[model samples]
Target chain A: MIKKIFSLIIIAGLLTVFIPIILNFSFQTDLPDVAKSYVEKGSKDLGAMNIVTAIIVTFRGLDTLGEVAVLFIAATGIAVLFRKNAINDKRPKQISKRDSSEILLTGIRLLAPVILIFGIYIFLNGHLSPGGGFQGGAVIATVVLLLFLSDSSYKINHKIFGFIESFSGVSYVIIGFLGLVLMGADNFLDNRILPLGEFGTILSAGAIPIIYTLVGLKVGTELASVLDNMKGDIE
Target chain B: MTDVFIIVLGLVMIVFAILALYLKDLVASVIAAGVLSLFASILYLIMQAPDVAMTEAAIGAGLLTMIFLLAIKKTKQIEDPND
Candidate 1:
């Protein structure tokens, strides 16, 4: 059944790719004039050097909220599956007992902090630059993965991770609601409610940077925790 | 320069994608698929679409590869091509 499904998918994908070429569909080269004008105007207003960041944080903030919720749901699903099997299964025995080279491990230790700092920097400047919460969070998790591989004994503090994950997730929503009351906005994540500081400043983009930072923290911590927890099971 | 790089990168990505599809070992195939995604990101950069490139790198190379590796660990390896 799986192989048949894969074959059908391949056939459908090939048909779509080939049919588009055979029919010669003309793709639009430019955005609508109204959208282009608004983009030009909004780029400056939003204080984002990267137009994509502006669209993500401001124009499409609600979609981002949904994406984060999806992440939370996935994490919960994994948690549920593991919790049910936790008591029945013994912790996986560590495989490949070969010791890592001290030099390689040292290099990883040195690099981990730099990667984490870079992720944080990206999250903090998300409103002003190209990087944002999701990217930064992934980067941070990459650092954790590096640590896990280079040092098998490395373990995450589950309590700290749980606290950080929950706090960041809750704070993200709270920040949005705060925007309603503090800025007297009618909606949850209205940027017009927050003080849009001087253009191009780190403090600019109203509540966007703060929100992204929270998202970054939540994602990074949760992903790292997931990967860390998987360590005991991959044997 | 960019156009030439893009053309070459696209070719490389296509090649890797084919390898990923045809390879016998599931783990190797997954890794090859990830390399294909990395090449796709390079093509995107050559085409001046960093945002898409970033997404491709993250979702395709990072997340997808990790998921495949986990799934492969859970399932029994295929012994015969038919089996």
Candidate 2:
């Protein structure tokens, strides 16, 4: 009872401290100068219909690259921590575990392809829509998770995932270098390597789609590997 | 209308967050946390940030919840009152 009351008191105190700030907050009526310029020229400058994508993929491209590297490091750390458990297990590859229900297996089989397609579509059309590489990659990882849940014996091939992840990471860096070599130091990760075609078209965002696609593939494989590492025996 | 929805969602999220903090069952706490994330994503959508909403829903609600559940499976499922 005392704990509950104390929690309530803390909550009330927080609300008291926060309410004034919330009430005083006013929406911005006009875009700031940098934002105004981006809103005005982002589509033309990057050929991306979605201004947010343009900013994330090109205007702050280096940041996105850094974010991908961070994710890779995290996944690698998990894999390394779990590697001993994976190597020590000498159980037969075909150990018979209890099978999942027929309904679940059937449902996953039916929905997996569609979900895969949707994930692909999200990253592919990221330049024109609100979705992007990270979101789409997460969605793809969800499919892998569903498959794992439906089949106790199902195992993702780490070799394939590793190849895809490394390839995408190297290609992403190569593309960034391409921008630097072709343009200038200031244009690293610039999407203007290819001509910015028609506005609002799927292929019009120059290399934004390609970059996002690489990011999606890398993120998807990294997340899947993390999930796989976590699925090892706890003993 | 959107303001009202956001306000309601915010309140509900707070309730879920408190529930998550206080729940004795670890699974229930994790689920409450996930529900809070789900409501937060909806609030983001109502505020016209679909990209952030997608991320909050996918990573925060979906993957984070699943990871928590998996971690709980590897450990204790209930909180010890004395601890």
Candidate 3:
């Protein structure tokens, strides 16, 4: 039954997908006008090396904001669903995870900082590279996961998580408002709020880098907090 | 060369998927699935979608695997109370 259903679904999906794809698709190298505009004007207008980053953080700022908000909601939902695992549980837990070896501990201590710096590099270089806020944030969460595994007693303070999460979220909205205030109504989420510095440098891309950084912080905190909530508290 | 690499990766990924399907041990199956995801991420990297590749590596291979392992452990602990 399951195989039959799966095959039926696959057939239906292919039937719906291939018709539009084969009919509307063109092999020509020429892009649509909108894409052409984005390619031609993206770097000059946004001063970002990555045209994709410019599109996400500037041209399609509202969509990115919505994406961030959706992630925040999903994280919140996970936390709520796992409410029993929150830090305040007083139940005596089985000592499941054993302590790491000294060598492992030492290795983690050395490697964690490097992993962290790489994650930050991805965050900071979003405009100049393929990685950006979401990728960088996941890398940060991986760091947190490493720390959590190496030591069970490693407690993530709610204060710090809340601060980073809320601060970045609020600041993201404020930055959008700043763009709206500085540029006209049509220029909401404008990267031109800050000076679009020389391209390929860290300081380039007006507010795109700042926005991406804020997004990274927000996403990282949310993911870390989600991991924390899932860590069934040790007694 | 790239085509050969792609073919090899695709074959390995299919092997992992089939192993995951046939494995009796849940943990082994989960590991196979994680390996599959990691391969998919590598394929994304080769296709120049580093953003998608990074996400698949971190979330699909890493986080989801950890979560599934934990869930399996919890279920086993509950089921075989003597263990």
Candidate 4:
């Protein structure tokens, strides 16, 4: 009875909220003033075909940096929470390669490389395409998750993980620091330092793609590490 | 026409969300949540926000579901409705 009542109330609330969206009449079609200027000027100023990437990696770089820091903190927290259990356990529990079907293994071998290439392509073309660092990085993390799903005992090298994770984080800051030094502290994360090649290309967008690539590596490694710890805790 | 598709997808999302809440098995609930994310991503795509759709599909459906499943593996594999 309580479940029925609760569900009914929730459904009613959702319907009320979604009615406008369902009608599609309340959806704003015109771009706001700030967004209008961004779309108009962003392509020429930032040399990024994807104005969203320009907004995220250039205009709001400090915000993106802060966001990445928040993600890093969350990753650190998860690591710390599961640290003891992860360390004490030397071996993976109840996992056997033989337990998985041969077909799955064959599929993984054939599909893993494609997924990886796709993820790299997503990040590499972030300036010109819909994908950016966070999206691509998450896609890359899926590769590790896929491996874990197939074989719980799949081991990722801690050394490589740590290197990729830390290097990306440090390089992000280093690039920002370069901006501060070269273009003044107020200009931290400015994209004008490097040559902004042709627009709508992989090599364009100055530092946006580089920053996004670093962001992807950091996010991907961080998530993979978190998943690793959780997998460790499972008996 | 697009509205019809949007409404249908939205309904599917709500249904999956309800199924997630109603399910007894923790893993099933997590899978339901993944399906919900998938629908949400499709909605984003239909709305022309491809970046958001990609992120939702990858992180929401893929990464989060795996995390939840691992958490379920670590904790109670099954939920007890009775206190």
Candidate 5:
């Protein structure tokens, strides 16, 4: 009771500190100078329908690359930690996973394909939509999670995942370097290496779709591997 | 109208956050946290940030919840008072 009351008092104190700030917060009515420029010229310069995608993929592309690298490191860390446990426990223990309900199994069977297609669509049309590689990759990872839940014996091929991850990461960096080689230092990760097709179409947006596709694949594989690690050793 | 919706969502999120903090059942706490993420995503949508909303919903609500559940499965289902 004392703990609960103390927590409540803390919450009340936080509210007291924050409520005035919230009340006084005024929403920005106009874009700042940098934002104004991006909003005005982003679509024309980057050939992406979604300005947010244009900014993330081209205007600040290097940051996104760093973000992907961070995710890779995190996934690698999980794999390393779990690998240590697997090596330490040489005894094979009996693993028991409860059988999923019929409803869940049937639902997953029907929904998996649709979810897969949706994830692909999200990344493929990232340059034109609100979702990009990270979101789509996460959606794809959820499918892996679903499969794990539904089938206890299901195993992911680590070799294939590793290949996909390395291939995508390498290709992404190569494409970024291609922009530098073709244009200049200022054009690193520039999408203009390929022709920027019609503005709002799927084939448009120059290399944005390709970059996002690679990002999506790398992110999906990394997340799946993390999930696989957490699933523990089945054998 | 949008302000009202945002305010309601914020209140609900706070309620869930507190519930998550206080819940004894680990699964219930995880679910509460997930619900907070779901509400946050909705708030993001209302604020005209669809990209952030999608990422938050997929990652915060879905994957994080699943990870927490998996961790719980590997451990205990209830919060121990002493430990």
Candidate 6:
């Protein structure tokens, strides 16, 4: 009775909120004039054909840095949770024959690579499109999850993840610092130092797409590793 | 028509999400939550933010649901009168 009442109240609240917001109905179809000019200029200045890439990597690189830290923290928290505790000392059970579905396994095997390739393509072409690090990273993690679902035998190496997590974190920071050294203190992750390639090309975004790719790899690997750790605990 | 379709879909998704939260069976609730997230991802796509949709599908539907299922497996389900 309580649960039902609570659910009704919540549903009513959402309906109330959504009705007003939907009625107010202004689609944000156009960027502000100043933002549009900046995007146009950024495409040229940052050597990125994709304005969003330039914005994420150069304009908001600090936010990306903090995001990486959050990933690290999440990984640490999961690791802590999975630590050998007597209270939660349930060992991972073997995958039962009944629980295994061949169709799911086969389909995942066929699709995982395609999804991963598509994710990489998105990351590589971020300088020329709307897709960037976060989008591509999430895509890659989806592939990892698919693999996990398909086969219980599969496992990720934790030592490698430790290296990857640390190296990527360090390199990202180092690259940002390098911009400081080369560009004479304009800003960290400033694109002035790298040669601006031809517009609309994959290589055009100077270091923006490169940084995004690294970030994608780091994020994808970290998330996959966390899920893998959870699997070990589950069994 | 497109706007109406979007609103209807959003309503459907919210309804499912509320059901998922209020459901008594933990496993059923988890699956319902996944369905809710999948619907929410579709809603994101309708909003012209495919990137957001992709993230929501991957993280909200995929990872979060998996995590919840694993958590449920580790712990015992609570008996509810509603069930």
**lDDT, each prediction:** 0.78, 0.89, 0.87, 0.87, 0.91, 0.79
Can you tell me which runs of candidate 2 are displaced by over 4 Å?
A: A1-24, A85-96
Instruction: Report the backbone clash tally of model 4.
Output: 0
Judged by DockQ cut-offs, is candidate 3 incorrect, acceptable, medium or high?
Answer: acceptable
Poorly placed runs, candidate 5 (over 4 Å):
A1-24, A84-88, A96-107
Question: Can you write out model 4's per-residue Cα lDDT over A8-108, one digit (the tens) per residue?
Answer: 99999999999988887665779999999999878878798988888998889999999999999998898888876546676668644466788997798
Question: lDDT per residue, candidate 6, B1-83, as tens digits?
Answer: 99899888878888888888887888888888899989988887877766668778877898788888877776766646844
- Candidates sorted by DockQ, descending order? 4, 5, 2, 6, 3, 1
Report the alpha-carbon TM-score of model 2 versus the true structure.
0.90
Candidate 2 global lDDT: 0.89
Better of 4 and 5 by lDDT: 5
Ranking by lDDT: 5, 2, 4, 3, 6, 1
- Evaluate model 2 with DockQ and give the value: 0.65
| Candidate 1, pairs of clashing residues | none
lDDT of model 1 at position A174: 79
* Candidate 1 C-alpha lDDT tens digits along B1-83: 86687777778888888988888888988999999888887777776777778767876689668767766776644536775
Look at candidate 4 and give me any clashing residue pairs: none
Point out where model 1 deviates above 4 Å: A1-22, A84-96, B1-4, B74-79
TM-scores for all candidates: the values are 0.85, 0.90, 0.86, 0.87, 0.91, 0.81
Across all candidates, the chain A TM-score values are 0.83, 0.86, 0.88, 0.83, 0.87, 0.79
Tens digit of lDDT per residue, candidate 5, span A10-96?
999999999999999998998899998887777877788888999998899999999999999999888887785556667778867
Rank order by TM-score, top first? 5, 2, 4, 3, 1, 6
RMSD of each: 3.3, 3.2, 3.9, 3.4, 2.8, 3.8
What local lDDT does model 1 show for residue B79? Answer: 37
Q: Which stretches of candidate 3 lie over 4 Å from their true place?
A: A1-28, A85-91, A94-97, B77-83
Across A1-235, the per-residue lDDT of candidate 1 in tens digits comes to: 9999999999999998999797887867999987796589566666666677777766777788888889888877777666636546566655677889999899998899998899899889876666788888888888888887888778888899899989988887777787678766566676655677888889886777888888899988878867765555545
| Location of the lowest summed lDDT over 10 successive residues in candidate 4 chain A | A90-99
Identify the superior model by DockQ, candidate 3 or candidate 5. Answer: 5
